[model samples]
Target: MKFLKILEKRKSIREYKSKKLSDSHFDLIDSLSNNLPNAVKNQGLEVNIFKDGSIISEKLDGIIGYHGIMIKAPHYLLIFGDENEVAYKMTGYLGEWLVLKLTKEDIGTCWIDVGANDRLIKEKLNLVSHKSVLGIIALGYPKSDARVSSIYAENDDKLISENRKGYPNTDIEYKDNIVSRRKPIEDIVFLSKWGNKITAEELDTRNYDEVFYYMRLAPSWTNRQPWKFILDGTKIILYIESSEQENNNYELIESGIAMLYFEVAMHGQGIPGYWNLEKLEDEKKYGAPDNYYYIGYYTF
Candidate 1:
């Protein structure tokens, strides 16, 4: 449970202290960014760190027409992808890992999904033609008055539901008391097949309690938690819960975030493993219900 303390304290802090980050902080962050796992490992996504905000402010002005979501942090990490589904997922995978690493260092971060001038950011970073900005991560120290209005209470033992509204519009303002809602375990975890609910007693992971718990706490867009897992021995099969909207691009990114969280939790306990996305065709042969689309698998 090395990350347990960090997972408990890692809140998306919108308000930040204006002090600059030291060179050591940037060096540690850069090291983590260089070493962490990504969707495409060797040739994965690229991350750029900006210690200044002048250009960022100009580029982010018209995103939602209000410019109210601007977070005045000393540093911002811009994540670039290859303008493809895998790259987008890699953004989430590597980005979330970097965020956790920062959290472990006692730094605060906020995942900015909207209100970004992605085009301007790409140009500022001088990215190649095929690459684009996936998203940005705001980094700084939390303000003295910053407090998280978490959905889970200190002593509340009840499993919560994942009934949240869709993504917010660009005009959305930052709130101090942000709620961190999570879906009940039965709603996301399956036994052997899709939709097969399992209780904590049936998880079968005798030593993986905290790892699975941290996986449930992974953040997602609009707090949708739009991913599910099917535990089969030491392998965890992933699925992007079907959405009738358009495509599952963003959902795939969220799934990648969840997978990285699981892997990080395992590594915190000295366990070793790697990801395997080559099972897409084989997973389809399993005939998972239409509600669940097979993504890939992570094996130990």
Candidate 2:
């Protein structure tokens, strides 16, 4: 199956086999490294492919003071970005592209955010001031009997806190379900304006099934899925639902990843488009609440 089909087939596999990947697999991965799409064109985003995850894994475990959440794999990918608006978005854009490339190679991956907070890990990647590890991906073949006994979201704020001793609310064990649940399209999507709902059937008739289908599946912190879409004719605007608490940059990164998925799925279905991140002039005219700020628009 193509990468588009693999979108739905892909699940976050926590258990991975210890065997090393073949040379041909790494060759394919290396070929795609230069071809990754950058939200900011020509921006220097670097990725480190660790064939043996031991060095970085040990550092992350030592710094975070926890060993349970970090997944062990034969290889890992770290996307380093300079702290800025464009770099944050590009981090997600390039990182997810690599994730999809690995998926196409039949390699399993799980996004590991907590691992990015380690000072030693960042130093090992040669990240200087203002540049840091944006995200990490655990890469390897999934074990034949791999199953996630439970799923939990790490508190992004606490991950980097100087006072943090361990991650909270991450050890709760649930049932043996392996697949993560996604919110239905109707709950996360709107027609022309916010709070104006429409069913997936409505979108399928308009030839938007592929775009919205994949966008809805984009991963987010804690599965908060803190995003909403506004479909106005041929334009699709992205928004993050408003929050009162201290804001984190991870949401913007996740939105960028979702935009990439939407674009790739469109291309997979023979549609062409690019994202426009410029804030809309009359964004409030669309009935979006004060809490829903514009992220960008997908123009076909």
Q: Could you tell me the lDDT of residue 24 within candidate 1?
A: 94
lDDT of 2 by residue, 93-182 (tens): 787777777777778877775434646666654546455776677888988856532112344455545343323433322223312366
- The number of clashing residue pairs in each candidate reads 0, 0
64-124, model 1: which lDDT tens digit per residue? 1112335446788877766665666677788777777788877878776532345665565
Q: Alpha carbon lDDT of residue 206, candidate 1? A: 48
**What does the lDDT come to for candidate 2?**
0.69
Top candidate by TM-score: 2
Model 1 residue 265 CA deviation (Å) reads 2.7
Model 1 TM-score? Answer: 0.77
RMSD, one per candidate, in order: 7.1, 4.9
- The residue pairs that clash in candidate 2, if any, are none
Per-residue error for 224 in candidate 1, Å, reads 1.8
